[model samples]
Target: MSDERRLDVLRAIVQDYVSTSEPVGSKALLERHHLGVSAATVRNDMAALEDEGLIAAPHTSAGRIPTDAGYRLFVDKLSQIKPLTRAERSAIETFLSQSVDLDDVVTRTVRLLSSLTGQVAVMQYPSLNAATVRHVELVSLAADRLMLVVILSTGQVEQRILELGSPTHLDDEAAVAQLRSRVNELSVGRRRAEAAVALVAAVAELEAPPGDAQGQSRAAVLRAVAGVLAEQREDRVVLAGTANLARSSNDFPLTLSPVLQALEEHVVLLRLLASMDGESRESVAVRIGAENPISDLASTSVVTASYTAGGVAGLGVLGPTRMNYPSTMAAVRAVARYVTEILNQ
Candidate 1:
């Protein structure tokens, strides 16, 4: 059989099985697709494909289903990712543009992706480590208490409250203002690591005597602000549409328990998201069936794209391997681009 004809047959089988959740047979392929070939020729092509392990017969059924290798070939051979319709583009913009903060953007993105792809959507919070310190505020709550607010360029806010050992100069309004000004001077416009180092050095420069309460309080506030900057370096993920998985329970023949458990364990999802960092932000990465590292996800597929230029964060959808790759890839890519645009703004 000609390789082109055989590939066309494989493509037909994959499309048919994915849509109908049923094995594809030679007769159905001829009826559904225009192959311009005889039934006998089509049968021969199917046999060849089966021999190549690209298609397989499940149980006693005469029909064939594409194997993981076949799906991989189909994905790799795709000429173009299907473009989102005007309505899809408008919906994405309308929904995401209304976001009020970083949390809202991530939350709305998860919902939008889930609604678009009919699969579980996962997104990583943009890496604050890459975000420059936009501003810092110190609010004096009491004679011995203060609130440190660290704002990042990514629109994320980190706040920590400090309780000094005793009443100190922070209790005076002018003293608090001076310290806030100094903190911003040292940390503003720098990345988290640089800001932390600067804040720590500022604290070390304090010449407070061992028994000096005011100097000690100022150093404590600076150290606490540095700690807040350091703490946000860890990555986090948000998930939505887990109910979509249960709705497609038939897709997971065994049970949805394992899949649900894996999703709850954010580490598994984070590792999967991180693994796609090598791909460019403009490219979509698809891991099908057994290609996933987690055994529990062996029956599933993950479609992901980096939403940041540095590829430090990403968003994706998870569904059965029988998913519609073209549309899903398009949605993931579209949403990722929109997210990147928002982050850039």
Candidate 2:
């Protein structure tokens, strides 16, 4: 009768469908929920919801399922995410607090989300091009080989190795010292890719040959920056809880396969997270089924929250279309907040 009663019915139907993975019928809704109405009245409400495109019934005798619009309404207006319990809060705090390095922090964060939610979890380390360099070190490994370590403001560490076309006349210790000074002189506090491109072009301009004064210095810098950016181009993308998808046998081929394929593409996931930029890190974003631009992901749903280290970088997570939005959103938002705090510390 009233919009309120219809909304209550919609919520009940969605919760029932999500748990049962089946269409919801009016008789079932009336039998299970204390909706204070007859089955006929409930059926009328379902029809209205269907007309509004919030719920759908697949067969003549079947019950209803919430459409994307329905879930969006639920997440945007009706859903109340239960807060993390004290135990969960303490455990997340403990796990994240243990990490003193960026790699450790992200690894633990992915595991934490997977364990807590039992869903496929994706965490994106910030784009290498967006980060400011904290420091760069050149360590000589051999007469003709050297290792370049690049540290970013987010505590991310990347190392690259460069082999000289021919051994330089300088001693290993002296060459390393000179290389570090030269690379950092140009790269520290700059973008690795941007600086690397510039440094490479700079080296390609030297008037002297490879072993000459201007040429040798420029070549060393070139090798170091190139190594670091090349390493970052093949970045890390950690995924867990894939077995959880196996439990869904109802529409396995149609629903799960595409999502799994999309997950394997690091570039796709990165682009998805990157496209959701401009939203504040604390805000929760909803991408409905089929709204995902990736055709493989069209049947899946994704909710993303950008986790940031103040001004340094941001990380994100992607899960299923039928996700427990309230709980998952809360878990993701809380973890992102705590992780940012840890990185800031």
Candidate 3:
């Protein structure tokens, strides 16, 4: 068989194996596809592929299966990512647009991704380290009670309430409005860490008339809130569709136990997803079989892409090596693109 025909045969084998979860035979290829070749010629090509370690025979008399190397070649050389349908796009937009807060948006996104790919979905929470302060909202509920909310450029919102050492500087709306203006002036447009430091310094220097306990209380509350926001630059990860692993448990040669345990380790997954760095957020990275760092994931494939600009965070999915790469890659790319747009809004 010619080189073109052999590659075509290889592609056909991978497709059939993924769809049916069974070994594919040369006769099956000819019977199912118009390869324009006799059974004997196809068997010869299969032998050549086996010699190259791309395909393997699991039984002495049965058909062939694609090896990890075979899957890699198929993904890199033969496949084009299938584009999302219009209905899929509309569903994503509708589900994400209804989010009322940052937490809600992330929860919905992870769940939506799982449903789309039919595999385990993972997302890294937006990194506060990449965020800049947009504004600081301060409210005095009572004499000693203060509520503080910090808004970030990435549309993430964090809030905290404080009990001051004494009465607040403002019990009236006019005075509270003035404090908000001053806080924004000190913090808005600055990096989150830098803004926190500046806000604390500005509040500390507040001048108070003699014996002004309320001014002291205000300074203390602002300082506490600033410190909290600065320390809140935590990076967390969210995962969904873990139960999907159980559905295809038979795919794993030994058992899915190790893979399940690895998925439960949030830190391990964060590092695994971040392993595909240095590429633009628009591109998808696929790691097959032993290509993954954790050996437990050796039986799996990971497809990843950064969600927002500058790759502030990442999102991806995990499935057996027999996964449908074209469709999975398309789903990941589309989800990441939509997530970026939503956060930007």
Local distance difference test values of all predictions, in order: 0.87, 0.72, 0.84
- Give the distance in Å from residue 11's predicted Cα in candidate 3 to where it truly belongs: 0.9
What ranges in model 2 sit over 4 Å off?
A: 27-39, 140-146, 165-182, 197-236, 251-255, 279-282, 309-320
lDDT, candidate 3, 1-345, per-residue tens: 688887898899999999998899988899888998888999999999999999998788659999999998898884567789999889888998898877787899889989988999998888787787887898888887878888887787778887775677678888788778877887888887787788778875774666886576657766876787678555788889999988889789899989999988988887887778555355899999999999999999998888773237888899899999998898888888888888878
Residue-wise lDDT of candidate 2 within 1-345, one digit each (tens)? 797897899889878887787789998898889999887899899999999999987677658888888887777774466889999899999999999787788889888888787666778775566777788887766666667777887777877677675564445576567656766777777776666766677666544664485357447557556655644544456776667667654634355667777888888887777666555355766677767788887666666677665243334455555667778878887888888888767
Query: Model 1, residue 268: what's the lDDT?
Result: 89
Q: Predict model 1's lDDT versus the native.
A: 0.87
Mind giving the per-residue lDDT tens digits that candidate 1 earns over 154-198? Answer: 778778787765675677789899999999999888888889899
> Model 1 compared with the native: what TM-score?
0.91
For model 3, what is the C-alpha lDDT against the true structure?
0.84
Off by over 4 Å in 3: 207-218, 309-311
TM-score of each prediction? 0.91, 0.80, 0.92
Which scores higher on lDDT, 1 or 3?
A: 1
The C-alpha RMSD of each candidate to the native structure, in angstroms, is: 2.4, 3.9, 2.2
